[model samples]
Target: MSSPQSPQSPQPSQQPKQGIACLGVLGVVALVVILLVVINRGGGGSSDDADASPSPYVPSSAPYTPPGDPYTPTTDPYASGDPYSSPSPEPSPYTSGTCLNGTLPDSTTAQSVSGVEEVSCSASDAHYKVIETVPLSTDLSRCNGNPRTQYAFSYRYTLNGATINSYVYCLVGLGSYAR
Candidate 1:
């Protein structure tokens, strides 16, 4: 009788299993490649048919005007370069109507006020222009700051021993708290 065989390691059977596993991985890789190719080619509208230069689509009724921005207030108006380099774009904060007091004093006309204290008009707290004339009733409204003073024109001199155009007073600064 043949001698009883000794228990053996599983190496012989493992070889076939490893071969099958490698084949299975290769099969999956090939399947994925095939699927990707099919999807890329199968889209109903191919990119080849697209226009070379796509234009912005606009409605037919009217000529397209790029939308104007709804007004938004900034913390500082003179935030840009030299203040005198370009004219400031005067801002309108009030939406409902013009403020009381009345519109900006006629730039063409010279006006004056008396017993008024002088202000820097360029100070931190006084950084705005007359966008609207505050109504007298609304002059002290939340939007108004401490009624800053500015000299539209101030001169003290005598021509023929008389003072002319000696002084003019105007309020400056945007008092729009609602903004």
Candidate 2:
């Protein structure tokens, strides 16, 4: 038969459990002390050292100033008036009765011609002679039905999307320069 145990004192079987609990508490206390020592060692300096030094960055309060006026307007030489003076105070070399030395396409299909220059009517190199002048038109119909006119030449000048000067010349073939 077993005897009853008192509440103030533990039984022999429970004594081992209390000893194990005390060892667990001592292990937790030791771990906490070790963790605190490692954290303090990893810190580079004390808090007092951080407070003694001044910060490196400082802000400016004065307004900024630029060196020169970068937004000034520039001057365009051809903006004031008509840069292409068609009918000048003096007579133009390309006017009627004058001659031009240049190549004309064999096809009478009417096309744009370049590399033509003014020449004297009597010159041997003169290919075509101007018979009439038509202003602001390159239309072949302007020279149509004219017996002496074999081809039409036009001139147009523009500045800044605006037509400055335009004209057309009625040409007559000279010698073997037909077509």
Candidate 3:
């Protein structure tokens, strides 16, 4: 029998396949470059160009407060008055005369005192001293409209010597005064 003819060697031509593959890759690369250029061009416009003609902003006139009369003076809500000019009423002298076992005098009175030179306290002795006597009015009418005046006398102390401080308070108002 004649030997079967060897199958034709597979053609070794790779150039056409390589060329087609290269063309496909080049096509994809070109598409990407074109897309990038379009995207960059689109992103270049700015809001500044749109606002090039800035209109002058004019504020509307506020409700006019017809120039000052006593009833319409500009009063500052947070303004404070001189403490000395309008002194608060003094609190009553502390009737208890001694600090209670676990209590101290209220600090408001201490602050209101006209002549408190210095205050000192010792933890061991549980004592306090105010170098100078502070004068305060205990009458409520004097400090009316002020809540701080009400409890002003509830706490206060004067250091006596080294081991004792006297606690004191004043009666604010008599019921008769309310009438």
Candidate 4:
């Protein structure tokens, strides 16, 4: 406990080991910082494999058609008729007494109803057929002052299994309303 040759603390010759260990830790930290700097410098930031570049700003153009312009009508322009003339009668494709799956004759088809015995909803077999079509009179007197005279055509559809009387009424080309 009282030996003068040996000191209470560690000897001076062993101090270099402490310094070496501290310096080694600092050297490893410096190497890690240098490696991070070199790796970041090599990268372009914009991922080339993932395609992170901003898309180009492109203004869209109108769609093109070959034969018919969508803005123009297909009807004959030189036909002798008034531009504001009244719409033709029975303009609707369907009327009352049409089933859900039933295919009724259109205005053009019904116009020549005298020729068509019945219209077939089926392409091969008889699925639904228009049995009878009678043109009712367009009289507003039946409906007091109401323009419901569009109920002019009476269509009847029949399916072999008990008749599903799904009556659907539709009329086109009523004159412009008093709006």
- The prediction achieving the highest TM-score against the true structure is 2
Tell me the TM-score of model 4: 0.23
Q: What is the lDDT of residue 28 in candidate 4?
A: 100
- In the range 32-115, model 2's lDDT, one tens digit per residue, is 998888867865456787569676876587667666765654666477777676545324537778899988665445677788
Badly placed stretches (over 4 Å) of model 2 are: 1-93, 106-110
Q: Model 4, residue 43: displacement in angstroms?
A: 5.2
Worst 10 contiguous positions by lDDT, candidate 1: 91-100
Better of 2 and 3 by TM-score: 2
Tens digits of per-residue lDDT, candidate 3, 1-179, equal 89878777766687789999999999999999988898678655567765688789776987556666858647764467653475333334323222212223344434443332212232333232222222343332333344433233323333443422333333222222211
lDDT of 2: 0.76
| Cα TM-score per model | 0.21, 0.44, 0.19, 0.23
Number of backbone collisions per candidate? 8, 0, 17, 0
lDDT of 4 at 83: 70
Considering TM-score, which of the candidate structures 3 and 4 is the better prediction for this target?
Answer: 4
Superposed by TM-score, candidate 1 places the C-alpha of residue 136 at a distance from the truth, in angstroms, of: 99
Residues 102-179, candidate 4, lDDT per residue (tens digit)? 233433222312322223333343223222233342232332323443322333333555433322333322223111
RMSD of 2: 19.4
Error of 1 at 79 (Å): 67
Backbone clashes (count) for model 4: 0
